[model samples]
Target chain A: MSGKLLQVVREDGQVEKALEPRLSDAQLKELYKHMLQVRLVDERGMLLQRQGRLGFYISAEGQEAVHVGAGYALEPEDWYYPHYRDPGVGMMRGVTIQEMFHQLYGNRADATHGKQMPNHYSWKDRNVVSVSSPLSTQIPQAVGTAYAMKYRGQRHVAMASFGDGSTSEGDFHVGLNFAAVWKLPCIFLCNNNQWAISVPLSKQTASESIAIKALAYGMEGVRVDGNDVLAVYRASKEAVDRARRGEGPTLIEAVTYRMSSHSSSDDATRYTPKEELEAWKRKDPILRFERYLRNKGVWDQAWADQLREQTNAQVAQAIQLAESQPKPKLGSIVDDVFAERTPQLEEQLADLQRTHPEVE
Target chain B: MSRELTVVQAVTDALRTEMRGDDSIILLGEDVGLNGGVFRATDGLQKEFGEARVIDTPLAEAGIIGTAIGMSLYGLKAVPEIQFLDFIYPAFDQIVNELAKFRYRSGGQYAPNVTIRAPYGGGIKGGHYHSQSTEAYFAHTAGLKVVVPSNPYDTKGLLIASIRDPDPVMFLEPKRIYRAMKGEVPEEAYTVPIGKAAVAKEGDDVTVVAYGSMLHVALQAAMKAEEQGVSAEVLDLRTLVPLDEDTFLQSVKKTGRLVVVHEAQRTAGFGAELVALAAEKAIEHIEAPMLRVTGLDTPFPYALENQYLPDVPRVLDAIQRTVSY
Candidate 1:
């Protein structure tokens, strides 16, 4: 729009693209397949909610490339603090479609043990921390983890992702500022989807760009086309590498869009215009990446058809498994409050059991 | 084996002892290292444990708490000091949303194992920001455990317990007794069980319940009432959430009168919640009335803090009112 916006390759759907660092034909296929899987998962999730299967859900549509691209750019040991709408990232990090669906359906088989609502998943041993519904709170926590990594003299990095709306919170700035000053290995990935719930970017912030905000904190800031998986991968790779090397934190704002209702409970048509939706629809992350991969000779109709069929069947099997699992135990209300339940909690638990005698 | 020490000094001793025993236990806060913290609760921890364990963080509340979470996730026992309880607002989101929900959201996959330490309650000349008792904020969160110690012994024991706890604990140290209340603590490693209320002076006529700095005032009021031949059971609620309702209900049933006291504002203070809870549980108990002795339903006044606090006179006054009503 102004002063030659950064681009990896000119977009015409037929233009040849250059090879990226560390991304071979196989890896690109891996990234694209995951992106496509995320898109279909998002579609099925929405349909499932409409059919009264899920209570509510956050969509990961239209931003698959940003999540997968960025996720693929990191090491397994690096800490990942994901926000609510992070199924794409989770899918890329070896979380099964079954585990994700099981968690969404509140099945006891859910990895979270049915503790959180849909889209909030975490593996304590996976180095990827569980995310809550609150926005921007993890920024400082991630920074703190990075500080500890530096303190422990480990070559690990700590990274957190949040929306553009999160940058307005005080903790977001405090975390980044502390990381920059202390030279902690923290990576802040800002998914600038242009909206936080109903508030648009115009009302949520007055800054020129979220990336620019990092400049004031003495951190490297990169703005990338979120639909371009190559660019997102490269930018995140360099930033994460610098963080792993202890050069301090870096902020990368992935310019993207929310292609669906904010959640199952939201109706975005009230605030978003048709033209705006169409404009963002044209930049669908999966299609753009598919175009790039096709020009690279790694994509064909046969592969596309196979991936679609396999993914649909896998998702269906996951849904059936998720639906078949039993609900969590209601008696667990008093468990884990302490190493052992206190007398007071025990009394309450007894009262609850008496009131609902059918449980336990 | 026993010696007299201020509440602040006992806390410092407990931290030093705990840190020396475990290498994973770390302390981080502004001025906690070089300046020895605002009240010196962590006076010599930095020098004793080295900078790696006793970290001096930047002047950022969010930074302090959020970073402690990271340390906790990394299998380190983290204790974050909020120089003053009133200064904890900036970090409320992190504590309530992240630290509190770590275990619940992760389905018990990850426990925060963090303790947020802050000095609360009135008596010194700290106007609004430093003197207010803000324990209710932490109590409302579903997964967090809140603890407030009334004296030097409880401070040391509860702090040691909080450090070993598997969940996030918002540990409130009474500012009023930081230097005033003196007591003898065990010279060995021990921890007071949280969620258990201590019966300071057991009786059957009336139940006067309070915690943190207000325990001293409540005890003093109970003594005066004892001289009047109306025995008052002073129950110090060491922990707020998962409240010791067993002790509270038992005391209320035996006494037939309930009077809750605290330095927090009256409208929806922890005292009010306790009164309602007790009423709902043991409503058949024939008490004179359920009364609450608390600060006025206003922010801690800058100049009139003394009049605003629920002191011995005010607590005694409330006890009289509950009995007469």
Candidate 2:
């Protein structure tokens, strides 16, 4: 299984000449910086949760390459339906570290008005639809968006990202089938992180690979090494191009591993083997990308250290800012239920205000 | 000018009218395009508007609904019909979680302009799978408005209104009377306001509340009660979510008695909500204990379908019970 994995950088820092020049030095550095920045934010989030500062956190630890690479490849007009683990994808699409922390803190400045759980973010301006907690539900939504795009004669595509566990959901099959049948300009990206919170891929399906499931829907399927940023970027870019060209959808399964617990609530050590974790640690996406950059002679120890210091400092400031924001108004809880607040909800809100006069 | 049309014809007329008026309005569902929908409610739409606007989708309710929500988010007004309301369970999660919560969850960032139409109710003997009166399931959802039009004239108006509404709506069509009954519908586009109940027949003694196909049953029951010297006021509740509490409450206050009727189960049905409303708000005005004529608390029976659904006699009996109490 490991032999089939694609690689742009070998363990000893050797690169493939053909793909090495595809990313300019500046672009490569930006990709590396984003991956490092998200990883740092994820670490700080976990630390904050441990200190009882934030309610919850879901880390994208070793899976940063998959989101960052694909996020950078997507056009600005493209729509993204992300899962909870893809905060880096949102960050790449212009969601600031401060906004991300604001949501995590469930503050008044958050877009959802402190309604949603941490890590479930949405941005209308960036075309990033909000992520629902249920798995694979967003797949059909992406299909619908792409269908509308094709109907409107637009060249933009919609990409829906999910975990390997989402394959078990019926929406995954239905969405892919509909997309294929209609030739929708959509891409289904399966982040095969092996563990769906304790359920392994072996139990998830009898099939060998999640990518191969696309064959049943009469679509192209590609399996990429999730840890290899260049491979993920190249595969996603091709699929995105094909979709925008009205060539229909493609399924890309990036096989990676979840190097952290499912969320702040879980203890992965109870279910995961220590040996497996140690092996995946050696193949960390950040280290592998740094090795490639070092081999390109565009990176140095001082630059990497400075990048870490800057991202950590930014994360600390964001945490402070999020904590200092005013509490969300109590009336906001009943607002946004509809375009205009119905009299029914207004009555309920009035009742709540009457009961809890101290808060207002 | 008005012409005679059946409920199905009114639905088609409304879709055609809305499609002609708004370019962004689209129709997507199973059998909606070439087949003209399972009940022909969308007949000739694909030919009139082309396949791009009227789409025949795969037989996946969840996908149809989820995609419709997405389309609405992207500025398309969608009317996706579930072939039958009985088979809406598979899409329940999408309707309740995604479509209903889009606006609230997004904090007004997204308001899905979608109208989900489904033919429902019993009387034609389609049995459990084809015949169901389950509007209560959707009416329970907060952000989703539920509409049921009893006649062809109201059907066109309500469908047009739901499509134009910025919020998502669950429009339940009465399958039993889809082609059975006919009424004069106006050619010009008109929207009957949602959250407003119609006074089908005004009387003094009792208020009989009903909607969809059961509105006819309530009328028949009211006529029979009139023959028996009990004048029953019949109320047609067009929308269940934004319920016309004022009309029903005023009628209950005027008549001093209430009888609710529906073709759904007895417990936790929309009828139960009406009874609770009268008890809570208009209790002092009520002279007798309120009663309801509803389907049996069981799966829509295949062999005894008539016995399962609330009928004219049952509604009359509920009125008699309330009048004599």
lDDT of prediction 1: 0.83
Off by over 4 Å in 2: A1-3
Candidate number achieving the greatest TM-score relative to the actual structure: 2
Highest DockQ against the true fold, candidate: 2
Colliding pairs, model 1? A144-B67
What TM-score does structure 1 among the candidates reach?
0.94
Encode model 2's per-residue lDDT on A1-360: one tens digit a residue: 222555566655677777553778889998998899889999999999999988889999999988887888898899998999887777777888998888898889988888788998888888888878988989998999998999899999999999999999999998999999999889998899999999999999998788888888988888887988888888889888888787999998998899999999999999999999998888888899888888779887898899899888888899999999876899998887777877788888999999999875
- Write down the DockQ of candidate 2: 0.80
| Angstrom error at residue B107, model 2 | 1.2
| Candidate 1 lDDT tens digits, A33-111 | 9888988888898999999999987887888777778888888888888887666666767788888899889887877
TM-score of chain B of each: 0.98, 0.98
TM-score of chain B of 2: 0.98
| TM-score list, all predictions | 0.94, 0.98
lDDT of 1 at B114: 93
**CAPRI quality of model 1:** medium
